[model samples]
Target: MFERFSDDERAIEGLPVRLVIALVVGIASLSVMMNTIGGLTALGVTELDVKPQPEVVAEGSNEITVTVITPEGEPVANATVVAKDGTATLSQIRPAKTGPDGKATLSLSPSLGPNQAEGTITLDVKPPAGGGYTDDRENTKLLVVSGGAQSS
Candidate 1:
């Protein structure tokens, strides 16, 4: 077979051109994938911002509104919001979920302690499944002043 083919042709067949082409393609694909991942990472994580509500409320159930969004201002839906008090005694908050608009309203009832009439409420907001987004939380103060005194 070597008699019919030139020496150069035989050397070329031994070079494994197909294998080299496949390796190059594989590397290119991997590079593209890595770049895509890096880009997504640079986009940063999600953020949760609790709207400004009354700092003081009566000794009853109060409603709080929170908004979840991305760094780019995109609404984050289906996020979980948890509220708790420092002493966990004078605050009753139910876990709420964000709607399509990234807004969740939580009902909080200020508990009156033996001698305490003011306390802080913490809101923990968690992103949806996947680690692509980071979780955020905030704290707000609530003072139990009088009955039906309106939130201030």
Candidate 2:
């Protein structure tokens, strides 16, 4: 003989536990995926190129032109360009903003150690705000030779 169960004994209460767990897991996964995509979109979308008029300079004052462009080589205007000392000693470099031509001229004074033969000055750029541009690529370097000698 089999015993019959009552309706109250078989009825489930509130939300199904499996459904609640699935909803929480789905929401968490969606949040993580969205964050990952957003972070990826914020990187390496732009490039910065530098052309030191002479490509090489003496141990004193120098001028360098920085160009902000996209991966397609299209110019990006209003970007800010910054300079930093690499293996060379340099005077404080003032940041410059690019014009409509995507060019910013920076004045820098690069110097070398008394015994160092040559060094390099590094350049970086920050694309205009809200343009979804990133300055994560290697820009360019300026060569500084000793004794006021320029590289051929």
Candidate 3:
């Protein structure tokens, strides 16, 4: 009985079926893009940077400091700093928080592992939760020499 309503009547009341569907599809596409971008940002898609200077130092005599920052030169604070020789030497520095200058220091070990006394080590800096920064590690020639009395 309702087959009498013509397409003109439906168009007069609102948009045509195709136009309505297009509007809904456009809105849904926009929403999907926004959500995708938000998810990527939350996943820490950005890569951070870590620079260590004076890569070499005398064990138990000096400390190796690493500066953490973003590609845009922004300082990253409240992150975890870890140093390792890629073997058995590892140090989880305390007060790992980066200062206003985005610098964190870790002491070198004087006690070498087995027959080794001094070598290179890699630095890993991870941003604090919800800190809006990504994790980074040293992939360059960052090394420190350890040859002195072990410091407490």
TM-score leader:
2
For candidate 2, give the lDDT of residue 23: 97
Off by over 4 Å in 3: 1-44, 87-95, 110-118, 136-141, 146-152
lDDT of each: 0.65, 0.78, 0.62
* Tens digits of lDDT, candidate 3, 1-94: 4566563365555557778999999999999999988877536455677766665555443576777777776767776666656543545433
Off by over 4 Å in 2: 1-15, 43-45
Candidate 1, residue 87: lDDT: 46
Candidate 1 vs candidate 3: which has greater TM-score?
A: 1
Task: Report per-prediction Cα RMSD to one decimal.
Answer: 7.7, 3.5, 6.9
Instruction: Report the lDDT tens digits of candidate 2 across residue range 1-152.
Output: 33665535434664588789999999999999999998886464554455445678888877777777776877789988888889998778668898998888888888898799989888778778977787776876888889967663
Ranking by lDDT: 2, 1, 3
lDDT string, candidate 1, 26-126, tens digits = 99999999999987753656554544256566667777676666656677788887776654344455688889888888677766566665555666777
Every model's TM-score? 0.53, 0.75, 0.52
* Candidate 1 residue runs with Cα over 4 Å from true position: 1-43, 52-55, 70-74, 87-93, 136-148
